[model samples]
Structures are given as structure tokens and as C-alpha cells.
Target: MFKEVLQQLGVKQNQSSAYHPQSQGALERFHQTLKSLLRAYCVELKGDWEEGLPWLMLAAREVVQDSLGFSPNQLVFGHKVRGPLALLHDGLKEVSDPPQGLLQYVEGFRRRLFLAGQMAKENLLNKQKKMKRLFDRNTESRVFCPGDQVLALLPLPTSPFCAKFLGPYTVVRQVSEQNYLISTPERKRHSQLCHVNLLKPFYSRFSESEKAPAAVAIASSVTEMAEDVKVPEDGILQPRLNNSETLKKLDEFVKHLPFKQRDELSSLISDFPMLFSDSPSRTNVIEHDIDVGDAKPIRQHFYRVSLEKQRHLESEIKYMIENNIAKPSFSSWASPCLLVGKPDGTYRFCTDYRKLNNITKPDSFPLPRMEDCVDAVGSALYVSKFDLLKGYWQVPLTTRAQEIASFITPSGLYSYSVMSFG
Candidate 1:
């Protein structure tokens, strides 16, 4: 049945691969040209696609090809094909002989094809120009220099930097023309050289008002503005509050706490001193005359907690001891520390060497690429996942490197016992 169909279509017998539809480039090109002509003619006629198909077929049959030097219809039918009007205009047909008429028709078709090709080229060029303009308008070219303080934008949910924009990092070095090394107070060691585009300037003014209490002058300024403005029925004419004055009031409020409470709060404020403003009217004195009738005074005791984050240090030491992962000596000065909680509901220690990791040279290890994995897995496979608990702590830290393993905590400084992992 297939043979009969091929014979009816006048297809020649050829190698199976050569005749395969996928391998028939010429046939594919012909189909594409036919589709383009059908679409164009349909658009020109503003008619239904099905109604335009016959006319497109006729046009294609009459079209001349430079390579073949003849229309496909002429080659297939052994005669030139005519359009609808050719049969009705007998006089028009009589003026030219068969060969001469064919030549004129081919010439006319060739001219139209040339014009269409030119129009197509122009359309393509216009599209490319529009695309280039759009691209140029959207492309960002902002750049920064070394030593400039920048805020690094971090991905959620574990960013160590400000919960908002991560950094106020100083660009310490230029790792590449486009990448820079940045450091922050929280990050004791240098961070990985990051792309310049990832950073923006830290606008200190944005947070300045939040730090300190608004001044009396700010309050007076708002009051003055309020006094001058008339309140509108729609509340559209409401006066803006002076933020500086609000900050001053907040400062005054903080200064009235008792001495012990003030001391504790003061310690908290010390780290962010800019958050408070001085107020002459406020005092830190505690009133001792408060009645304690029939009530026994409770005694309070203070004990020093180790500021050194020992829990993290111990985890690192355990990892080093177990895995024997080779690492540099833990430097007391360089080791990064983190606070952890003890089993007894107290604080313990940990250290993060992420900054140090950034500086450490990366090993040239080969890993499987996604494409290779996809190919190897083919189209049918099930996958399972597992995780190692306390994976890093399972390894122990070297004894000589213990000093570098030291970390800072609220209580005191301490060293780690295990190899640490970021």
C-alpha cells in the first residue's frame, strides 16, 4: 500500500534515510515557502485562511525558481499553469506564442518575488532596530569603586546581614574588574568578591531618624506647620509630623528608667547608640523611698558567662576529631563565633568560618553537570534524598588550631573542640 501511494505521487525510490521526512531538507523548505505565501496572500485579501489557500496554491504554481529556471507546476505537469482570467481572455492569449507567453509570465513572477524579498528584508531590519532600542533602554550600567561602602542584597531566609539590605560593607579589594571584596563589622573576615551589580550604596540618612529621638525643634517645626495649615474636609490638607521632634520625645522617654533597668537597657543601647538622643529633662535616678511593707527583699547574684562561643567550637572540634578534615589552625583573633544555647537553658558557643571560607582557595574538583545527569538518568528513574545530622561536628578539630577556633559570645570568649563548617 505504501509503495502504491509513493508510485501515485511519482516519488522516486531512494535510500530509506534519504527519503525520510526528517532528512528531506528541500521538501521542508518548500513547505515553509508555501505556508509563508498562503499567510501573506490571506492577510492581503483579508479573507478566511481556507478561502485564500486555492489562490496561494495557484500563485505558488506560477512562481519561478532561479535554481530550476521553471515553475514547479511546469516541471510537474509538463506545461505552464494559468490563473483564473487566462481562459476568459482569448485575445490576450493569442497575442503571444506558447514559449513567449511562458517566458513573459516567468519574468513577471520573478519581478514580484524580488520585490517581496526586498520588503521581507526591510521588515526584518526594522524589527532588529526596535529590539536593539528596547535592549539599550533596559540595560543598567551603574558601577562602584573600591573603598566605597555598599549594601549587599541577600537572598532570604538565612541572610546574616541586616534583615533588610545585608551590608554596609567597605569594598576592601577588587577581585576582578567587575567583582569586589567587601567586609562588614559582623563579618570579621573578608567576604567573597561579589558582582558590582549586586550592591547599592548604604543610605545612612534612611536610618538616622530611626536611631535617635526626634528633637524639640522638630516638634516645634511640625506644630508651626500645623498651625499655618487649615484642615480640609477630605483630610488632604493634614500637616506632616516633624520626624526629628518625635525622635527627641522618644529619647526623653528612655532616660526615666530606674538605675538597674537603665543600666541593662543602656548596655543594649550602647551597641546602637545612635538610636538614643540626650534629654536634659530626663534622669536615671531610682527612688529608694518606695514602700516594701511586710515584704522580704529578694537577693540577686551576677555570674560571668563565657563570651567565647564554646558549643560551636566544640562542634567544630568534634567534626575535626571524627572526619580528620584538614584545615588551618583556629586563630583566636580570626575565628568567627556564634551563640548557642546550653542543654540547661543557658548560652553556649559556635563559630562561623564563612568569611575565612571566602578567602580560602577553592579546590578544582569536577562535578556532574545537569545535562550529563539528565542524559544518564534518561526518561525513567526514581530519586531518594537523605541528610547527615551534625555532619560537620562529627569531625574533630586539630589541637594546635584550637586558639584560632576561639569565638566571642555575650558572656566571654571561648575555643572550639570540633572542626567547624559554615
Candidate 2:
């Protein structure tokens, strides 16, 4: 059936020799890992594995591979998949203005991909060299030259043992380290590529007793080649918090402040760095409550989300739970959430509260206008501006408001413990 489909689609089907999965060892290893993940996720139950396969794939893609030192997603996409936690961490980074057009964006993406792929390739090569050295340890290399007689391990047609060393075939040439090309019958072409492990020295009965293991001259050379690939062991680099670096940047920022207030503000920031933390801060001073004023609760089903979007949503939900910003809820009011894409390629999580908003009672209290604030501040000696990080999150939510702001996703229903944008 597959062959017919391939033929119909004009696709050529090139397959490797049967029972030789080692030809594509990397693919086989991937299959093994994927199966292990699926089996573990099932918790010993066998059926319905496909249901969790997408999530398992996302998990695997996000994980850093030992050989490459990078997650597959990062190597391919030039960045790690971002959610709420990643978005918050991104704030700590100094980002430049993004490219202006499609061509510029493509150029930027191309540069990133090239750099990431080159680094990944270098890391993979380093790991391969280390593994090769470890594998060659204590193992002898059988170096063969052209015209050497050697017994090649071959599969038997019918015997107690499935295979036997049947050849005293002449060596065609040396390929690399322990691998060689062998002269074989036309029908035996497929098995002619032999490793040192599969070939043994062919000796006459008289010389069998006196012959030494393959040649010491070339064997030491192979070992030396293996050792030549040794790289210096790298130290584990732990990420240290650089308060000094933060303060240095802060000092640069405060240089723009008024001469008299600069020192006092700098001292305050140095003393209480926690006030400007990247993480959200909440206050007990104000607990906001949403009043529907006798209107019916709004319960809307979640919108359909793509697998990629769902993966991000799942990550955002996990972050919210860990930070105590949101929790599982059984609220009667349920609103759907949307992931709005930002210009910088990140997403903004928002709850669809239009239905709830229509029923919400509006506050009628009057407040001073911006003109009045400017007029009042005109008489002051100094004017300063304050900006809060995650301003909406700084305010707490009332218990009743939490239930009223519940939103649903594929994972389940959750409600915010603080104010959230719609």
C-alpha cells in the first residue's frame, strides 16, 4: 500500500538493508526514547497512547540533547518555545529593536539559525569525540592492508548458529579506523563492508601457533589517533546572581535623575533591590472585586487551540500555578482565553471577558483629571514618575472576583488570584 502511494505521488522509496537498524542508529535511538516516554506517561496502561503523543513530542523537543547541548526546537527555530515564565525571563534580557520587514526578519532568522546550528554541530562533534575515545578504551584495533587474508563473519543459510566466519577473503582497502572494504562474491556484496570485530586474521596451521594479534605497528597508531581527539574537560558553569552588575546598570539609569535626588534614589535602590525584581509583586493594600450586580454568571466554552498553542497554554498554566497567580477552580463563571501574538514574536495571554463585562456594574465615582494633577504638581519643588512592573498583578483579587474571573482551557478551569488583562 505504501509502495503504491509512493508511486502515485512520484516519490522514490529508498530503503536500507533489512535487519540493519544500526545504519540509522540515531533514528532508532529516537524511537526508543519516544516509546519510553509514551510508556511512562501511560503509567503501565497500554492503550490510547496517541492521545498523549503530541505533548510527549513537545516535551522531547524542548529538552536539551546530550550530544548537541541544545534543545531540538532551539536548534531548529533559533529560540526556545516561550510561555509566561519565558516571557518574564525575557524581560531580564536587553533586546534590540526587531527587524522592520519580511526580508529583514528573514535575514535575522537566517543569522540566528546559522549561529545556533553551527554551535550545535560543534558541540555534537565534541561529544562524539569523547564517546569515541571512551569506546576505544581497552579495545584493540585490527589494522588490515590490501591483499591481507581475513575471515569475514557471514550469515549462514541453515546451521545451529545463525552466522559464522566463513571467509579468507582478500582485503580491498582500509576505509577508516577499524572499518574496511572487502573483496567478495557479487551475491555477497551487501555484507562486504566489515568492521574489525567481524574479521579475524586468517593463518596457516603452521603459523597459527606463532602468529601475534593483527599488527602492533598500526594498532598503536589507531590508539594514538583516538587519543588525539581528546578535548579539555569543561567545568560546570553555575549561573551566579550578579547584584553588582544590576547595580551598575541601575547607576547608569539613575544618572539621568535630578542631581539632588539621584544619590538618595540610588541608595534606596541599592538597599532594596527587591523592589525592582523581575518577578511580579502583590499588595494587600488593595483587593479588586468585579461586581456583576445580580446579572447571571457567564460560562463560555474554551476556543479551539492548535497543538502548538495548547503546549504554550499548558506551560503558562504551570507557571501560574507555581507562582500562585492562579489555581484550579470550580467556578460557575467560565470565560475562554486567547493567546494574542505580540510584534516581538511572543504571546500575550488574555481572558475573553466581553460577556462578563457586559453584565459588570460600572463604578460611578468621579476622579481628578490629568490637567488637575499637572496644575497641582506645578507648585511642587520636584516631580518624579514611578513605573510598576506587572502593574495589574500588583493588585490582589477578592475571593468573589476570583470565582467570577474563571477561565477554561484544555487542561481544566483556572481562575486568577490577581487582576489579569482581558
TM-scores for every candidate against the unseen true structure: 0.23, 0.38
> How well does candidate 1 score on lDDT at residue 333?
41
The lDDT values for all models are 0.54, 0.80
How do the residues 43-132 of candidate 2 rate in per-residue lDDT, one tens digit apiece? 866658998888778878878898888888888788777643345557888575564898877887788889889988999999889977
Q: Give me the runs in candidate 2 sitting further than 4 Å from their true place.
A: 1-265, 341-345, 378-382
Candidate 1, residue 226: Cα displacement in angstroms equals 73
Query: In model 2, which residue pairs have backbone atoms overlapping below 3 Å?
Result: none
Per residue, candidate 1 scores C-alpha lDDT tens digits across 36-120 of 8777877788878888777767776667664455566655544556764344455566776645587887787777566555654
Prediction 2 global C-alpha lDDT:
0.80
Local lDDT at 305 for model 2: 97
